[model samples]
Target: MHELAITQSIVEAVTQRLPDAQVTRVCLVIGKLSGVSVPSVEFCFGPTTEGTALAGAELQVEQTGGRVRCRHCGDEFPCDDLLAVCACGSVELEVIAGQELLIRSVEVRNHV
Candidate 1:
């Protein structure tokens, strides 16, 4: 699954950032509309980090809801899914947030 690949990439990036550090936790910001499977990422984390500095590291995922601003009525509201629209029956909308997949931060201990 792509989660494996994504997890591997995340591990690599974090390891490169902290070459001699022992990773403790990775905090990720996942948008609800981003289509990323949180469970799959968690499943792949252990395997991808095995034998690496990030071994035994914890994965923390923060999910954000979808939001859109209506162009017609200038109203902002939360959307249940990726379909960006407003209740005012307006198809034109500008997304304010919730379409992001970002690595927010990492907690690590320096190797002694």
Candidate 2:
């Protein structure tokens, strides 16, 4: 699965940002439309983080619903599906969020 690659990337990025620190936890903001599976990420995290600073790090995920802004009426609403349509019967919808895969924070212990 691509989650392996994604997890590896996460570990690399976090370690690069906090070099010499041991990562204790990782908080991620995942959106409904992000197309990334939480279970898959969780499954791949340990293996991907092996032998790295992120080893044994706990993953905390915060899932967000899909939010879209209607271009025709400038209305913002939560969409359950990716139909790209607004409730006002407009096909012009701009995704304001819900496709995000962001690292909110990282808890790390400083190296001696």
Candidate 3:
């Protein structure tokens, strides 16, 4: 799964930042339109970190609301359940959120 690759990248990045530290948790901000499933990520994290310092580490995903701006009305509103539509009944819209995929933060314990 792609989540495995994503997790591998996270492990690589964390290790790079703290070579002698043990990762305790990973906080990820995943938008609804990011196309990455939280369950899938969690499912792959265990296997991906099996032999890495992140083994047994917790993976936390924070979901954010999707937002879209109406090009015709210039109004911004939640678009979680809508399809590029504005409250003013305009179809011309641009997605402003719900497509983010990034690591927010990593918690680690330094090795003495």
Top candidate on TM-score is: 2
Q: Rank by TM-score, descending?
A: 2, 1, 3
Residue 8 Cα positional deviation in candidate 2, in Å, after optimal superposition: 1.1
| Residue pairs that clash (backbone atoms under 3 angstroms), model 3 | none
Model 1: per-residue Cα lDDT over 1-112, one tens digit each? 8878888999999999898888999999988877778899999999899999999999999999888888899999897575656778888887788888889999988556
Candidate 3 Cα outliers beyond 4 Å, as residue runs: 110-112
Of the pair 2 and 3, which is ahead by TM-score? 2
- Candidate 3: deviation at residue 8, Å? 2.1
lDDT at position 24, candidate 2: 96
Best candidate, lDDT: 2
Q: Which ten residues in a row have the lowest lDDT in candidate 1?
A: 79-88
Instruction: Write down the RMSD of candidate 3 (Cα, Å).
Output: 1.9
Residue 81 alpha-carbon offset, candidate 3, angstroms: 4.5
Q: List the residue pairs that clash in candidate 1.
A: none
Question: What TM-score number comes out for model 3?
Answer: 0.85
Give the per-residue lDDT digits (tens) of candidate 2, residues 1-112: 8878888899889988988888999999989888899899989988888899899999999989998889899999887578767777998888888898989999987666
